[model samples]
Target: MLTTEIREAFLPYCLPDITDEEVNEVVQSLKSGWLAKGPRTIEFEKKFAEYVGAEHAVAMNSCTAALHIALLSANIGPGDEVITTPMTFAASANTIIHVGAVPVFADIDPETGCIDPDEIAKKVTPRTKAIIPVHYSGHSCDLDAIYEIADKHGLFVSEDAAHAIYTRYKGRMIGDNPKGAVSYSFYATKNLSTGEGGMLVTNNEEIANRARVLITHGMSRNAWNRYAKGGSWKYDIEEPGYKYNMFDIQASLGLIQLDRLEEMQQRRAQIADRYNRAFSELAAVKVPTVSEGTTTHSWHLYVLRVNPAELRIDRDQLIEELKERNVGTSVHFIPVHLMTAYSKKFGYKKGDFPNAEAWFENIVSLPLYPSMTDDDVDYVISSVQDIVHKFGK
Candidate 1:
């Protein structure tokens, strides 16, 4: 074990970068007594839509809810199938099941861990109604190819952009397409921290309106409006819907977080660059790859691949070693097919998604958050190098 004369505390894998402005805004909301979905939520939605260059934005309690409502709005239900990558959070696929649709897994590009458009094309059947491309690790998937496939198949594109809040493809933001609805997350560790919140952005007015109603218990009018001055107490529920509305407290934090997003994103990019430079020459480590024409990446995670043959230790062992050195790390995902729930229910085997399984075997996500200082970054780099030198074949 390597020990330093001056010891540092264990560094967490990810941390939310919150400022006093967020705290103050939340406090103001608390004092206003308009706690539930109200003016602040509405303002956040409007500003988020404008920021993403979308026609409408609906704030929700979670990205899973946003995705579920997006599928519902698209009218994807029983006997329908949604194509998605296996190398993503379970919520991306689970949302399809929530809407009574089948989630068909597609193989990912081995280099990018994003759904391969070609694989998606092959997976389309008569029952396939939509393509849910997940922006894995904040890298924009091949949107042009996926969009082309969607057009040819006449399928909807509901993007699970949980990791791609600020990612862009061909100078256009991820959530700007009308044919596709994009869902974003403001989970505690997301680039933008709202504790637990999400937003759905789309250009179709009808879809937006349907989602708005569906997120608030299917009520025609919200409680804040009905109880406000000169407002009617009458309300109607046209359909059964989930309670997924974002509260003013969450929106208050989001409103300020949005203001700092650009700067935070820059810091993330700098950290990624530093990691790349430090690991580029190492034979055992494989740095992440970006598409040629993409303008900006949100860099939500800095995932590295370890060549088992070059390194005497396996990916899990590397993670264990990092922990021993007081550095935290994580795995982006375990392929859905490998999870007990999916495997047992769907009768899926380990070989079902070879690409996803292969990537999962070698991947580990390093610490890459905006809150990390320069010294923190250097320590991580040094720790990784030391491990490689000690363990490499």
Candidate 2:
């Protein structure tokens, strides 16, 4: 039994870990006067590339931009099929649509909530051109298996590492020495925050070069610095491209956040450990699972699954119960295939992917962030325990 009762105030599901240092850094960028993809953004990209052991990194306004540029740079177009899991944010599939390619939905490995490599293999055809495997909740996909399939079929692999900035696969960082391209999110909710930004990393220089041009309205090389010192006014337009560059202000937050990633991650891990310990004993709850291929999980979202048969309350009722206790919660995803856009466009129905649909019905992401205090962690754990005890069948 929990000794502490529910708190008086509502605990938010997410809040970026920010401090005076971050505020001061943003002020510094403002004072510097050059805000559009300036030195700071460049420096952050260089540091991020090195951090992930990639040869090149391009900053973008969002992960959607990075994912789109990744496909565009690779020449994946109409008539091409890009396989990705339906168990992710719509951005994963939306990017494929934006690239003029068909987004092929693959079911996930229910245990890890990542795209099943076997399912990916089954989706391959002569038209299949790429695979955008998302690392769900910072848990890595089966890279070895996915890559083997990619290699056999001569397909491009664009990893959607939106939740995997700190994730590792078989002891290698998710972006380290990538077989293709990897896109990472620096959204406010991520472990590393840039307010709203993303990075596309690759070891291939040609793709990197093209990605650079593709991000800034297709202006010729070095035009990003035309406004700075020793700059030239005249530049050529190579092709039509999107305005997706990250400004210095966001990079200012990114630089400091990147430096503090280890500290933030430690706190998140402690909170996760507490959740795991507390929830493992509950017959009605299943704690998030880290796949064997995942050497390190980024701990981006602490998702818990409730076995409906063991609980009198369904997942929605569980959320309401927690809400009544002043605890906030969220669902990681509601399978992309089931969304109206995909359903109406692609004829996807609920039963199309049973595993993903089942996983969706079972999950509720709890509050887990670096700023959460020990008391907050305990309260969340106790709150969950209380719910289970009250609702368990």
Candidate 3:
């Protein structure tokens, strides 16, 4: 049981580092009245493209929408198969189903929790139209191998980079290549948040133009421009598309967030370092690892793996103890295959993905956000140590 003092000073699992600048930007957007996908959205797209080293960017309402559009732009549809990891959020796999495509699950590298290139290679078939590699916890996947496989199979590569805004692979940005598109999330808890938004980045002009058209009801131009200067009201719907455009209001927040991204990322790295140093000596906990040649991890989620055999308590009990101590924590994800929707739909069994299932049983995401104070980090570390010492076998 946690003591009253610890409970009173417990830290939140994730906190958005919104500052006065973000608030002011939102206020300014409100006053401008051009709150839809207008100037701010365009500006954000340009800035984001530059930030990610992509040739083009299309802002949308959510990463899910961006991913859906990325697939659609690639002409992926019914009977098409997309390979992805089972260890990620369902959205990564669900986006494939959304487009009438089949999502084939690939096992992850147990160490990094990223889709194993070898597993992805084994799953490829004639119907495999695309491969979606998720950068789990902001750690770069084996892109070298994944891309080589894609090249050999002549398949498209669309990255589910929801956790990799600042991650890099071999000195290149995750989405820098136009051969495949990369989708980023700006959800409230993401590295670069616009409350709830996403962006699709690509170097191919054709895909970029098509994605822009598909995001706005398949119209020739966006609604923000239908009534703007030199823009006519008349338009034609080329293809039926979803309503997934980003509002300028969200872009307002994004602009400021981008400005402070480096500072925020630095803080997150510092916290990760502190946690790593404190937890490295504990045999009951396994800290995340970064591979050689990888640079700039976004530090999105600090997932700690507990050795159940070494500790008397289980992962759930650890979470419960953290809650009891008022130190909020969360699970990075429950593998998609484990969920009822995915299980019954796909006839997936518990042992379908041994690495992912095993990881799920022992993983816990600690409180890891840029806004955490030193004191907050200290509290979380102390609370974790207290639990481990008390419960370790």
On lDDT, the leading prediction is 2
- Spell out the clash pairs found in candidate 3: none
Question: Which stretches of candidate 3 lie above 4 Å from their native place?
Answer: 1-4
Write candidate 1's Cα lDDT for 128-178 as tens digits.
999999999999999889999999989999999899988998888888755
| TM-score of every prediction relative to native | 0.98, 0.98, 0.97
- Show the lowest summed lDDT stretch of 10 residues, model 2: 1-10
User: Stretches of candidate 1 above 4 Å error?
Assistant: 1-6
The worst-scoring run of ten residues by lDDT in candidate 1 lies at 1-10
RMSD of each: 1.4, 1.0, 1.5
lDDT of each: 0.91, 0.93, 0.91
Q: After superposition, how far is residue 115 of candidate 2 from its true place, in Å?
A: 0.5
lDDT of 2 by residue, 241-260 (tens): 98999999999999999999
State the displacement of the C-alpha of residue 159, model 2, in Å, after optimal TM-score superposition.
Answer: 0.3
| Candidate 1 overall lDDT versus native | 0.91
Count of backbone collisions within predicted model 3: 0
Which portions of model 2 miss their true places by more than 4 Å? 1-4
